[model samples]
Target: PISAAAFGVAGPIVNGVAKITNLSWTIDQIEVAHALDLAADKVQLLNDLEAMATAVPFLLPEDVQTLNTAEPVAQRPIAVVAPGTGLGEAFLTWNGRRYVAFPSEGGHADFAPGDSLQLRLLNYLAPQYGHVSVERVCSGIGIPNLYAFLRDEKIAEEPQWLREMMDQVDDIVPVIIQHAFDKAAAVPICVQTMEMFAHILAAEAGNMALKLLSRGGVYLGGGLPPRILPMLQAPRFMELFYGKGRFAQLMAQIPVYIILNQRTGLLGAGYAALALDESL
Candidate 1:
């Protein structure tokens, strides 16, 4: 167990050097050893996204659900995006025989809303924050903020039961989603909340793929995508994903898959370890 994770973009020391990202605390190998109670040489650090990206090619065929129908895995640039603590973006390149993956801080890119509605939402969001990054709007952790925004915007009404239920918890998206899927406690307002959430997500997904020009396909591999599996309306999601004006035609041809397996991220980490080992 880590006694404490302290750093400023410095990762664990591999050969006496590392950059851990979050900066609440900054410590070196000795500090890490003292904090974690482990042999300094035994502890290791790896970039979470880099580790996950390395696992793409290794994903078992059945682990991913194809959204668009295309199989150009070997011929072009392959990208993976995961929405964890923040949006993690990575891409891989194949040159006939093998692939190499690279990590990206592209998740921090400014959020560009596609339509008047999105712009309106941004206008509402901008006043509250410095710069509205996509992670500020699209990730699961970000969803509740949007929910409150919507609630305040009067886009939808929350019933008393739902309001009280929501007020009792820090995050209401997951519970709301489960309610929606169960059709048990999901009310009219809850359904509206999720629908709005989904639309924003779709728009972001489209923007991400377009920016990458990932012709091979886009696989939704984040923690949230699978939980909302019961509600994923491909046509609706596609409508928003490919809604870009000039590039709609091109975006339509690309494939998309949702990774169903919960262990995919872990698999990706293992794959990266093997790759790093092979390199050594």
Candidate 2:
């Protein structure tokens, strides 16, 4: 019998009901309690990013890898950027006694191009999506969109073999990423797609760091980062991250890390449940 439980949902939880984004399900806290046979007040729901942010304080050293050497300032705001099925954003700041995580839908914000190539890509995508959001070119779904742009725009050639592989897979992101890292595959288009993905992700992360002034640190959490660790470590990613003209120096000093532990969201929910116990 469970005494307490917390869920990290993919969308905002309003009035104890979460209309899960990218999916059709709408979850209610009361329904969850009934399904689990737990007390009504024992269940807590949070945005996925909020849950991940909450788990930041509890992360063990081994759970993360430093992407940059900038030191963290104690008690300062912490920022989280995740690109999965959809991009997610959140932050945590001290509220005297504890760090409170705040969820945001910042991923849906307009995509801002930083270079000529990005500007061209934006023009290419604008017709299809009236408002190109950061999530449109930065998440799991975004990979294919970028891949298509590279292929159709003649930026890169999509070989017949790669086309066949993409045709066989329902989700083309993995196929593209796999071939991108496979030097033997000789798939230049796939590799270029991945590079573009890293560039956009890094740029967005830097944008978040600046927006929040997250001096505590910026944590990258998602399905993409861990799998593409090699790419993220390369100079290209860092170049884009610190390319903010006026803020380059400040960007270089903000600590950055990739969350290696995949269970961060669940762990955060567990911590939230424990907090409820203490409060009670």
- Which regions of candidate 2 deviate over 4 angstroms? 34-39
- In the range 180-258, model 1's lDDT, one tens digit per residue, is 6665556655566566666777777777678778776676666777777655555787788889899998888777777
lDDT of each: 0.67, 0.90
Q: After superposition, how far is residue 146 of candidate 1 from its true place, in Å?
A: 1.8
Model number with the top lDDT: 2
Q: Can you give the TM-score per candidate against the true fold?
A: 0.80, 0.95
Please give, for residues 1-280, the per-residue lDDT of candidate 2 as tens digits: 5778999988789999999877999999999989989878888998888899899988999999898889998888999999987898899999988888999999999999988988998999999999999999999989999999999999999889779877887999989888889967548998988889899999999999999889999999988899989999998888888889999999998988999999999999998888776556
Q: For model 1, where is the 10-residue window of minimal lDDT?
A: 1-10
**Residue 33 displacement (Å), model 1:** 12
